[model samples]
Target: MNHEFSIESRQFNLWYGDFQALFDIDIGIRQGIITALIGPSGCGKTTLLRSVNRINERLGYVRTEGLMKVMQKNILDSDVELAQLRKQVGMVFQRPNPLPLSIRDNILFAHKLHTQSHEKLSRQDENNLVENVLRQVLLWDSVKERLHQKAIDLSLEEQQKLCIARLLPVKPSILLMDEPCSALDPKGTEAVEELLWELRGQYTILIVTHNMAQARRVSDESIFMLMGKLMEHAPTDQMFVTPACKETADYIEGRYG
Candidate 1:
């Protein structure tokens, strides 16, 4: 219930039909900090991230129990407005997926949705929004001259940056990135990492990654999961150096996944 907490989950459980994916998970994420979720494949890292934003609610057999909140509002409540909640918390996926439209339109699409019902943005306002967010993601310089070009025509890394740019125009308070750098090359990964660091002051970020080095580089706090359970959560440096749990220490030391 603390206003400083951006995300909090209490006794959260998730199931897909007869299979239970997450079991009574409790976690809290502070505002304006990067929280990294690290775990081996099939350990439910991505599931937890998706649930935070209610993306998993789309699955027919998927059911969740307990409380999950963002900015002190209950996300699991049926009466909540999902559209508005999603605007407060945005997500970036493992692969880059840009719309078939032009670069300018991709960023404009969401802005139009959120702003249209209130008041339409002037042409100059729209242009400034697109340019500003692109610059924030460090893609403006390269794509400034080609704002009208098709989004699909850009390189993979550029497309990914554009996706991040698209989210920024809406001004979400929390950003969920699920293996965002997995598809990028070394240079591209570095660029995304730098962008994440730069965004720390403005947005609360939670990243799910298998790469320990990436977690250490961009995260202030770390949460480790295994077999659909939280093993440990601590400051990033301490989690890597002096993990409190034997399982966490063994996993980080490469003894076993």
Candidate 2:
């Protein structure tokens, strides 16, 4: 476990009931940079992403082999706490899914849940947190006056921004995003990409995206998967300009998904 990597998988395999979705996944996701997972639909990109936070295990029949580690600790151990794992590994889904609560409350929800009652923050501290996170996601000015409004009422872009904002108060070290921009329009996608750039070097970002252009533009490294197997992993530019494998080249060139 090199300190330079935030997440590592060794011989990782996963199955949903009798259907295997991932095979021999060995990866070392570098710290403090964005890594994009790209492949066609049903290639196990999302499955790999969800495994980072153990989200795939929600299905009772799902089973896994090998280790998935974060910060050098294997999270597959029976004693590992789901609550704590999720706190350190925040996830953003394909669509914005803000809680049906006030905007302020939504920002405060995770902080409040993770903090012990005796360690609760003062009202002023909570206010500062909400403001800081919103500003981090570039949403402060637009919704500053609407803190009490229901989060669901925000525009789709704002709602997605808020979803990302709400994760900050907990100080997550890794963010696992599954097609985070898929539901957004072009303008919204651009805004979110800007936010991703702003967030770079502060957290380890692993994003699953079908958009090759977006992956090339936003990620420092790119990972290509095919039929539940890792095909290539390299610097984004190198992978795009000179893929080492024919499968990788074919997928990038749009010859095949």
Candidate 3:
């Protein structure tokens, strides 16, 4: 267990029924930095990301071996509570999936869920919380006047920003994003990338992105995976400019996935 690492995997292996998706994955994701997971389709980037919060177990058929740790605790332990674990780890899906509720309510949803039943915030405090998180995501000015409107009404970009905003009230130490800009246009992608830069150093962000340009633009560190194996992990510039592995070089040079 390394203090500098927010997430660490020790010989981690995962399987969907009989088919293994991850093979002896051993990596340490440093704390409070943005790391990008890159690979072609079916290379298990998402699987590895989902494993941090144990979302893979939702399928029931998913089984895992080896250790996956977040904040130095092994979440696979039976005593670990998913609800509390989720508080420390937040996820942004490939597509925006904001709750079908008001923007204000959406931001408050997770906070309320994690709050003790007896612990309650006054309406004013709630408003402050909403404003604070929305501002953090750089969305408050745009959505401030429409807090009561349904979140679904926002454009894809706003919806995605709101989705990211909602996760903040819980104060998650790690954010797992699976190609969060995949559903957005170029402008939207740029906006989200800027927001990610704003969020750097505040949280440990692990993003899975197929877009090579986006990976290079935003990540401090880059990880290259192939066939469910970690091929290379290096500084973003180093990996792009001078990849260590032959396979990594090949992949970056427009070779076969």
Candidate 4:
């Protein structure tokens, strides 16, 4: 079952002051699949991921030319509301950055911010919302008993999962994860990889990772970028077995970054 493109970038160029970070990037990321963006450090993989949700704009010096569309709406247009756009596109950082609040409140925080009627949400409504998203991220069974515990007190893996769960209440169509496992141990990485599989077909996930092995394990499609330029984007198996570009092959072979 093929879904429509969740994100499309056409002739997209981004610059941080005089230094350009992305060059004419063009791709259509399909809905409901995990797509991995891989490259060496400073290769602009994160830059492109940040671009999808317009997070790069937070840096006042940054500028862009061309188009970036999320959910078929051209987000580059000035009329697009940042809050609504962010609600549709969620982002997770390299390190788990759960709020200092309790796990339950962390999950409800975004929903409360986006929702106009917090007082209207009954006691049962909030509890149901918390349980639903926690289960979605597979954190329910483990943290169910301590829903009100400080989110930071949880293990790194639990914190990461909570970060993901917190986004669900907003009903984002696309999730931009930048090295989500970079801060985790091997076991934690594996657990999150499993979570990614569980999330497939429900949310379009674009993840950036330096670990090619992780990319191969979790991604349906792989995109390799080099020095701010996209070298190749193809099915994960094909890209690993027989990359169409020498740049891609060399990078995968550890010959170059």
lDDT: worst 10-residue window of model 2: 54-63
lDDT of 2 by residue, 1-257 (tens): 68899999999999989999999999999999999999988999999999999998887888999999999989999999999999999999999999999999999999999999999899999999999999999999999999999999999999999999999999999999998899999999999999999999999999999999999999999999999999999999999999999999989999987
Q: Tell me the tens digit of each residue's lDDT in model 1 across 44-73.
A: 989999998898878878999999989998
lDDT of 3 at 222: 94
Q: After superposition, how far is residue 221 of candidate 2 from its true place, in Å?
A: 0.3
Q: What Cα-based lDDT does every candidate model obtain?
A: 0.91, 0.95, 0.95, 0.92
Is 2 or 4 the stronger prediction by TM-score? 2
lDDT of 4 by residue, 1-257 (tens): 12398999899999999999999999889989999999988999999999988888888899999988898889999899999999999999999999999999999998998988636588798899999999999889999999988999999999999999999998998999999999999999998999999999999999999998999999999999999998899999999999999989998999976
Candidate 1 lDDT score relative to the true structure? 0.91
Q: Candidate 3, residues 91-204: lDDT per residue as tens digits? A: 999999999999999999999999987789999999999999999999999999999999999999999999999999999999999999999999999999999999999999
Backbone clashes (count) for model 2: 0
RMSD of each: 1.0, 0.6, 0.7, 1.7
TM-score of each: 0.98, 0.99, 0.99, 0.97
On TM-score, the stronger of 1 and 2 is 2
- Please report the TM-score between candidate 3 and the true structure: 0.99
Candidate 4 clashing pairs, residues 3+ apart or interchain: none
Could you tally the backbone clashes for each prediction? 0, 0, 0, 0
Error of 4 at 252 (Å): 0.6
